[model samples]
Target: MSTLEIRDLHVSVDTETGPKEILRGVDLTVSSGQTHAIMGPNGSGKSTLAYSLAGHPKYTVTSGTVTLDGEDVLAMSVDERARAGLFLAMQYPVEVPGVSVSNFLRTAKTAVDGESPKLRTWVKDVKNSMQSLAIDDAFAERDLNTGFSGGEKKRHEILQLELLKPKFAVLDETDSGLDIDALRVVSDGVNRFTADGDKGVMLITHYTRILRYIKPDHVHVFIAGRVAEEGGPELADKLEEHGYVDYAGASA
Candidate 1:
């Protein structure tokens, strides 16, 4: 069983004033088949944690270690991490103007699966996922997120999630900027992907709206670049009502 563990992980970024710390000796452990949500205000290093797990070079891992099934994830390259069964759904998914959805999926499938999915089977599987998400098949012919609506872009991210089937996923504010309908669609897709009992989710978000659809097994309140409180799903409801003022003060 593949597990993602972050042990006293500290991250920093280069700044004029020297290194600015983001994640401050954070510790988390997520085994397969669990969903953990990290919620906090802006600059809480939620996204920074996600990016660091995915091996983004900009955020320096100043100390500690991240392990995937006991393997050192910190040592893996960006592509290596992806191949090692990690995925990140960015808060602002980037648009690639020249890459069609089909091409992108095929390339990624080849990379992750270590072989090309048979064209006939791959098309059917993709279409099935799209249908479940209420996505138009015609959308696949368009460039990857080029000229896509906000909802469309988010759904496209879900499409990748479904197709890639990563062992561990870091969804960075996937609920941000989504309308009610789009939120439901994206949430539905996430629920489907995380349903298989072999994957885990580390969801970083500021809002509780998405939690209604995909209930997290655990919730952590991030404060001052570290998790200040850890609890169950009820923690999300508490944060919804009271907000993070208490967390901010305590962490400070």
Candidate 2:
């Protein structure tokens, strides 16, 4: 099984004042076949951790080591990381005005797999995945995420997950803005991806609702950019009842 390890990760971002630290010496590990839930309140550096793992230029890794199966992830370029089996489904998926969803998915799949898929098989696979996600056939011809509803955008993100089949997926608040039906559809798609027990998932969110659908093997409570407490599914229940108020002092 593959492993993604994070050790003493400290990240900072440039503000109008200066570079401000967000993640403060955080550490975690996610192995294939496990789903890790990172829960926290707003401004608690949860998204920072997600973007950092994806090597977003806005967040600089001042000191840390992120590795995927003993390979240096911090050193790899953004696309290189994806090719190495790292995928990030952004909370706010960006709009690619001119790129058709069909073309974008094909391009991304080719880039990750190092070869283009056979046209016939690729078409069939895309059609099936889209159908499973309840996406309309016309969506494949539309511009990627352009003018789509929040639920539509999120569903499209899962579409990419199904097609790309990355070793690890970091989903940043995927449950946000999703209605009950859409949530179930998206959660089911994630379940399908991890059903083989060979994929790792880092699900970052503020609520425990998604946990009901996609159970996590470990639940990490993030406070002030660090892990304040961690437990099994039980911890998510606690957060749902108590919220992050108990961990408020960590930031001070």
- Which has the greatest lDDT? 2
Q: CA lDDT of each candidate?
A: 0.91, 0.95
Instruction: Estimate, for each residue in 30-112, the C-alpha lDDT of model 2 and write its tens digit.
Output: 99999999999888899999999999999999998999999999999999999999999999999999999999999999999
**Model 2 off-target regions past 4 Å?**
none
Off by over 4 Å in 1: none
lDDT of 2 at 187: 98
lDDT by residue (11-49, candidate 1, tens digit) is 999899899998898999998999999999998889999
Candidate 2 has an lDDT of 0.95
RMSD to native for every prediction? 1.0, 0.6
Residue 55 local lDDT, model 2: 92
Ten contiguous residues minimizing lDDT sum, candidate 2: 243-252
